[model samples]
Every structure is written in C-alpha cells, then in structure tokens.
Target: MYKSPLALMVSLSTLAQYAAAAGFIDDSQLTLSLRNNHFTTDNRESRGKIGNAAYTGQNKEWGQAFVLSYASGYTLGVVGFGIDALGQLGVRLDGGGKAGKAGVSRTPGQLFPLESDNSAVDDYAKLGLTGKARFAKSELRVGTLQPKLPVLLSNDGRLLPQTYEGYQLTSKDIKNLTLVGGLIEHAVGRSSTNDTGLAVNGGTRQSNKFTYAGGDWAVTPALTAQYYYGKLEDYYVQHFVGLTHVLPIANDQSLKTDLRYFRTSADGANDTAAGRAEGYAGAGYASTTGKIDSRVWSAAFTYTLGSHTLMVGQQQLSGGSGFYQVAQNSLPNEGAGPGSYYLLTDRQVSSFIRAGERTRFAQYSYDFAGLGVPGLSASMIYLKGDEIRTANGPDQHEWERDIALDYVVQGGPLKGVTFSVRQASLRSGAVSDLDQTRLLVNYKLRLL
Candidate 1:
C-alpha cells in the first residue's frame, strides 16, 4: 500500500487536537509570492574545434507560490505538542521553444515532470506536514523538515524549495550553544513532488542514507565555532570545523574573519574490497585505480567602514582529489546549484581547490543606505583560481570577475520588493569557457 506519511501525520494531529479538552491554534499564516525571471547565457570558447562561438539563448520563467501554515500551542500540559502543514503550487508561463526552450519547462517538457508521453507538465503541487513536541529548550519534529546546517542544507533556489521527509532533534539547553541532529531518508527536489534519493554532483546514480550531528558554540560575543560530522551510508565520512570572529578596528569599523576546514576520507563499506566491488567507491574522486582523499581549508576577512565593505580570502586544497559530497540530481549553485553565493572563501570557479589547487579572491561592496539611499547597493568581486593539479596536464589557472546591483523598495505600494542584476566575466587558461551573465528579479507578498 502506498501511504503518504505527511498526509497521515496531519490527519492524526487534527484528530488528536479534537480529542483534547482545550486547544489553542497559535498562528495561521499564509504567504503568496510571484517571481518572474529572464535568463540569458552565452558561452565562448577560446580554443578547440568544439565551436568557437556558442549560441546565445534566453529563458523566461514565471513562478507562483502559495503557503498555508498552521501552528498550535500546547494545551496546558507539561509536554507541548503542535502540528505544522505546508502546501505548495508552481506554474510555468511564457517559457517555450520560441522564447528559447532553455529550461525544463520546454523541450523534453517535464517543466516540472514528464507525463506518460514524456512531455513537460505545466503545473505541480505538494503538501507536507510535521508533528512536533517541545519541552524546555528542546524540540523534536517528525515528517517534513528544513535543515540549515552546513552538512545538510535545504535548497531553496527555485520556484519551490526542496524539502526533506525526516525527523530532527534540536536542543538549546546550554547557554550560547545550539545542538542539532537529524536522520534524513528522502528529499523532494525543487521541481518534483516525488521524493528521490540523495546524490552528490558529478557522481554515480545512487542514493545513500544521510546521518549527521553537529553543534555550534558562541565562544564569545564576537567569536563562534562549529564542528560537525556527516556520514553517507556505504560512502565516505566527512568532518568539518569552522570559526568566525569579529575584530574591532577603527572608529565604527570592524574586521570579520571566517575560517573553515574540512577533512574527508573513506570509511565502513567504502573501505572493504567487497564493498568497493558493490559500488561503494567513497566520495571525492573515484577512479578505476582507487579512491582519493581530500583536505580543504579556507580563510577570509572582511573590513567594514562607512558604507563600504572590502573582503579578501584564500583557499587551498590538499589531497588525492577534490572535495566530495553526495551526488546531486540537478545544477550546482551557492549552496546547491550554479551561480552560488560564494561566502568569501568559496572557491567554486573551476572547482579550483581541486587536488593541489590554490585560489585567492577579493570582493568590495557599497551600501547606498548610508549615503541616503536605503534600498540601493552595489558589489564587485574577483577571484583567481590556479595551481589545479590533474593527471591530464600541468597546473592550470582560471579567474572570474562578478558585478552586481540591487535595490529594494522600502515603502509605498511595492514596499519590500527587490530587484537584482548580476554580470560575470570568466577567463580560463586550462578550460575553453570565457564568460557568463545572470539576472534575477524576486518579490514576496505576505498574506495572513
């Protein structure tokens, strides 16, 4: 029998609430959001007969999201209980072959998913519910969960964010420290209602069970540290440590520093020859010869003064191969897909920070608010990644420059609305690609 756990939880919670002597529905909130985006990309190769000038194309996407959330407070009991529900809907508009079937909404269709004939479906929807219990500063939630830890982050980059069907335990009993642990078995992709297994980018087609535990500690008012351990069944084990601090500088100025380190190695089933024979090749780089281990470190510092902030960072990779993660089913960005927001030390360009690779980056930003314009901002960032070591050739290098502008309406009819434009130029001596650009506009509306 195919039964939906989310549906069952919501039903059971509602029934239980009716049985209670007195129940209070704490809050019921609804939100409606619409986002329209026009994306264009042009790829130009510097060498090779692979085509000198890649064609230029554009895609227009329209997304509508509706969320209805309900939370109930405890009913005068020692153990507090509650229920939460979320419903989502997405639709495609103005995106087809003529406008450049550059996205999932056209071409093979399946804008969201394919029908029996393998054509794109124009609309999709999903419902999720979570039952929770809280006591003191600890809470346990089962069913739909959106975890935001470094090891297990929910991707919310698309029309509808991905969600996990799992259970999570969070505790903040200790002052200045927060603890989180979870077991996730499945994930629903941004464009799909079906829950699929987990995979890393450029990895084999298989899903591994994910288990993780971590904690963050605020060592001081201006300093914080974090450590986490993550495991994917039949694969590698990952450990991460991070530290952040704010150093006071001149008058009304400060320098913020962030440092992160990750060490990944094979374990359990991945270490056994029989396990290797069964396709448990670990993470990072996997070849017919053997698997590779990886260690990466990054440090960044930002100086804030007046309306401007300047940032510089460097990253180094040492190991048999590059950093590794679970296989991914879609594009790569800041947290998940392409065009990710590099947080100072993110060496995403060329995946430099590959084995034996070193990368350096610098960024500058100015907020017009201090100069009387509250909603306007501009930023420019440049990153140079080099020393990429691979068996194919000698060390290679690549560089990219990005410029962005943003504005948000502070008041009036469109208050809280935001607009953003981003442009990038990339050059690589090792790779043939030259440049790319992305523009995005987003807005949100709250209905309660």
Candidate 2:
C-alpha cells in the first residue's frame, strides 16, 4: 500500500511507460524509473539517552523514489555537443508512525530540516544538468557529479541522493591505466537538494573545500596498482596505496589478491590555532595541543571456481585516533557512520581500527548465470573485529553477517532494470547498537 502522492506518481510512471511503448510513442528522448525501498530494524541497545538507555522497539519504514530524465544528442558536426537534464523525486509510502523512526538522515525531505514533524515528509525533488566533452581516450566533465572514489563517494542509500558540484578530468591515455583528478568546492545534501557549505564531525560549521588526485596503473594483464591523495580543508589529510593481482591457476580458474594501505594525519587549519579556534576537532587521542596520527593496512584474497567465489581478508589499525575525514553537516554517507572511517581498517558493522584493533572477514558468492539464470546472484559476508585497546583496556569485540540477493530483467520491456534485497545482523560487546535490514530496488534508463 502507498501513502504519499509521490508513490502514486511512481506507479503512474510505470503505467505511462507501458502505455507509451504500446502506443508507439516516438521522437522524444524520455525515460522514467522507479525505486522502492522497505527497511525494518530492531535496536536492542538504547532507547532513551546516549549512555543510559533501554531496548527500543522494532521499527518499519517504506520509501519510494522516481526519476525522469531527458536528453538530446548533438547535431552532426566536427565538434559535437549536447545537453542533458535529470529530475529526481521521492516520497514516503509507509512507516513514519510509532513503528517507523529515522535511521539515516540521507533520505530526502522538504518540510523538515532533518526529520519530518512526527512523520516522514510527503515529497522532495531536485534538478541536475551537465556539460560534457569527449575526445579519444580522454573526457572532461564540468558541473554536478556523483563520483564513487575513496574520499568522496556519492551516498545513494536514501531517496534524492547527495551530489557534488565540481570539475573532473579522467583519461585512459595508456593501456589499462586510468587517471583522475578533481576539485570540489560545495555539496548538496541528500534532503535539501541545494548546494551548501561543508564541515567535519564535532567541528564548527564552516565552508570547507575538498580536493583529490588519484591514478590506477596496470603493470601486467593481471596486476594493477592504485594510489590517491585527498584533503578536506581544516580537517585531515589521507593517502592511499593499493595493489591487485590475479593469478591463473588452471583452465577457467584463478586467484585474486588485493593489498591496501592508508596513512592519515592532521592538516591545514586543523594544525593551527586559528583553525582550532574556528571549532575544529581531532579524532583519537588528541593531546592538550590536539594532534593525531593514524595508519591502516588490509589484504584480501579471492578464489574463483565455476560459479562460486570465496574471499577472505584481514585488516589492522594503529597509532593516533581512528581515521578522519570531512564531517557531515546535515547527513552521513552509507559507510561513514559514527566511529567509522574511510580506511581499510573499517570493518562491516564495526570499525576495527580504533586506537588498536584488528579485524578478519570472509565472504562467499554464487552466480546463478552458471545455472542458466543470467541475471540472478547471491552473496553472504561475515566479519569479526577484536583486539581493540585504548586507555580503558582490551576487552571489546564485535561481528556482523550480511546476505544479499540481486536480479535484473534480461529481456522484455523491463530489460535493464535491477532489483536487490539485503539483510544484515550485527552484535557487539563493545560500544555500539543492534540489527537492521535494508531492501532496495533500482532502475536505470539511457535517454541519449
């Protein structure tokens, strides 16, 4: 059952698609997509306050999103150019009652700054435009972007989704090598759909710019290396290095290995008194003068045989406080929750990289395409985090298990659409919370 006008709009969109296709509608580059998400969670840890709390009841939520896009290709010429526009809208279909509470602030809303008045907001919308140029193996884009990088990943867990306004340069000038560099000055939160300032967690509200540079190099047909650097104004500086190798074992069999490392420290205004005076805060063992340093390392390996793949990984963190980054002013990204960092030391459901923590993880995946179903797959992952030591002592441990199923329409009018469902269970003896479930559906259309 649907509760908001936006839900009705999504349904109507699907119907309109079928109707247009049936009526042989032509000459217009129009595309309609709908995504429905249902989330249910049980928080057994806290109900009242921060420290003192009881078990909270189960919560249920339902949300729907609609995206309508239009684009026209450039006319024939030596230099070709085109314009593209995107329209996004979201609505709360159910939940918002006592059973449904706010879990993540990434969801879109119009009436309320963060949460709606006792209930989820009825609807929200945003418009995006892009100017692009291409030549040979290199291309440049200026305007809004949703980049999935180590430092500035676009969070799409909620409705409208967060977007960055910036300029990016990408090139594949060399074989099997990709280079990227960008400067971003502003961000639009998931809810508001308006470009605003930036800030880090526990820091004073200020406009902080983000800049990053990175490259991936292929040494061989089976080996690759990656390196990147990122900085958030008055926050922390991060450097990342990674290597991946694929080893051939036999006919149609291979072993894949991944090695990653990160080094982080204080930077810019965070290193000065004026910046600290402006309300900047540091993570992990901040001294009287407020300085911190951190290191993280991780390695993972996967073995593939027929339709099954098995993976195992280990990660460790040491030195100053946990990893740090640009804090969220209004909402947090999917993996950037409290006590979490953008490092190899970040374990699912728990950050293994505290003052001193180690984590181990294993995962298994199956492709039904090998069984004749082309677009169905399943995966399960488990992670255990322990050996966390601080001024208090080493007496904390946590673990999480996740299962996921995914499928996409391979043929027919709904071809190219995708659907996914995920479930997660987490337990901890350390300072954390309880279990949660997330269901997501995604549909993409190419209008060019």
Among all candidates shown, the one with the greatest TM-score:
1
Q: Report the C-alpha lDDT of model 2 over 1-448, residue by residue, as the tens digit.
A: 1344465455545544653554423433667777787776666673212354556566666778777765444433454444445567766676554433444332322221234344455565666665666566666777777777766677565555667777888889778889988877766666454565555655554554778889889999899999989887777788989899999998868899999888877777777777767666564444323444678888999999988999999988776565555545523322222212454434334455555567889999999999999999999988887766544544466777888899988999989778888887777655546676777888876542
lDDT of 1 by residue, 1-448 (tens): 0144345435544644553424544443334555544433345555432236543333234445433444555544678877766666665554434334453223332124445654445666777778889889999999888777767767565556778878889999999999998887777776667766665444343454788899999999999999988887666688889999999987869999999888877666565777665555533233322353678888989999989999998988877766665544542221223222123444323455456668898899999999899999999988888777655646667787878899998999889888877676667665566444445566766543
| Model 1 lDDT at residue 369 | 92
Runs in model 2 with CA error above 4 Å? 1-31, 46-52, 69-82, 97-118, 282-292, 327-353, 391-395, 409-417
TM-score of each: 0.82, 0.80
Each prediction's Cα lDDT score?
0.64, 0.66
Q: Which candidate is the best by lDDT?
A: 2
Q: What does the lDDT come to for candidate 1?
A: 0.64
The TM-score measured for candidate 2 stands at 0.80
